[model samples]
Target: MNIGIIGGGAIGLLCASYLSQHHDITVLTRRKEQAEEIRTSGLKRTVKGETFRASVKARAGITGVFDLLIVTVKYHHLQEVLDGLSTLPRQRILFLQNGMAHLLDLENWDTSHSIYIGVVEHGAMKVSDHAVNHTGIGVIKWGAFHPEDTAAVRNALNETPAQFQMIYTDEWKKVLEEKLLVNVCINPLTALLHVKNGELIANPAYEYMMKCAFEEALSILGLAEKERLWSHVVSICKKTAANQSSMLQDIVKGRETERKAIVGYLLKKAQAQEITAPHLTFFNRSLEVLEKKQTKSFE
Candidate 1:
């Protein structure tokens, strides 16, 4: 398949590097400098302390359409990118992201296109223009984002590289809900506290607080009745204990974290249902303050 990956951040470049072995890859980005740097050299994928450069077509703009267009931008940036790619390939479009799909209204995107929501545990960060630091490798769960085109997505992923075989059921909502619970628990707390995730484990107070946040999200998702939600949230935090989530990374870079997309979205849902979201409300307020302060600093 000719794959056009939107957004050349860590995830985008890494996916381009890996999937290129099987499919023809073209990395699209609006960031001209990053795109130029990658085209001049290549992608340096550093995983497990070793690295290699994988050469692929890197460009700033994507014209016409592709057989597959995998959108991987941050949640907040999706709308703009989608609008830019208004003519995005109608077939084999995959959404490999982390967090919830609260960007509702995409169902009208394309009735013929197979929209697949994939969750990646692949830990990667852009160290330089052409370098990506992959902290860990894990499974990717994908499934039909639409009700009827399920088989199309299934077969497309079935023939993908074995590494991407981590593709599983398209129970996208459940997968997203599961990830949202974990993100609520760890992301904001880590970003606000300015600590690596691993450090949070040793602090019992923060650990409990994180657990509380997770429970808050679960309650909002009706997962409070499920015992597995609790265990899953705790386990992911412990597993990625030492890592700094994208939320924290954004803070370090003086950029706005995905506070609105993650916690704010949950709070909105609870508000619509007339349910209390005290913790979420508190976190959103605090993060908003931090964002404002950070913005003023930049100004």
Candidate 2:
């Protein structure tokens, strides 16, 4: 299978390296230098203290058609990527963006293309343009966005390395919502306080704030099993104690965070539902301030 992976970020490099083992992989990057570097040095992935390299075709922009196009770009870049995709021939696309905001854009997507939504559970960091560090090994759960055949792509992806797992499910929306809930609980607080995930649960005050955010998000999402969901969020914090949340990383690097996609989406939903979400509103406003500060500092 010829698999085209858009976005040369951490997740993109990680997928290209692992999936290249079983399939022909082509990585579409935003910069010509990065694409040239990848083509010259190959895609490098380090996992569990061991490093591996896989040769993959690299290009600066979208080119040939692919059997499967897995988009690993951030939510903020989805619109730009979709605009580019519109010119290409129809193909199966699987979106691996973090927040649910991209779903709104997909509603008006070209119906001729087969669309799929997925949540990536793996933790990865880009070491360089052509290299990535696989911090945590986890499965990617995905489902067809609309009724369509997925057996070929599913079977092809599942045959890869054991550590890189692909799971197919019919309830992809629930998976996304649960992931969003976890993000809402941890990301904003961690980003604002500049703390690691463990500190959120380790500090009493921080833990209380996280709970407040969790309760608000749970209500806004209208998800049942409050206790169970809260426990899951806490467990994630414990599991990734030493690691920084993606939001925190964005803050530290002075890059734009996904506050709009995750928190902003919830805030809008809260408004539509007429549910008061003070904590969420506070987080959103605080993050906006921090983002502005970072931008000014960079300037």
Cα lDDT of model 1 by residue, 112-171, tens digit: 556667787677788887788878677678776666646544565566655445476757
TM-score of each: 0.91, 0.97
True-vs-predicted CA distance for residue 48, candidate 1, Å: 0.4
Q: All predictions: root-mean-square deviation over Cα?
A: 2.5, 1.8
**Candidate 2 TM-score versus the reference:** 0.97
Tens-digit lDDT string for candidate 2 (1-299): 99999999989999999999899999999999999999999988999899999999999987679999999999899899998998888899999999799998899776577999999998888899999999988899999998888899888878888999889999999999999999999999999999999999999999999999999999999999998999999999999998888999898988899998999999999999999999999999999989778554643
The candidate maximizing lDDT is 2
Collision pairs in model 2? none
Leading candidate by TM-score? 2
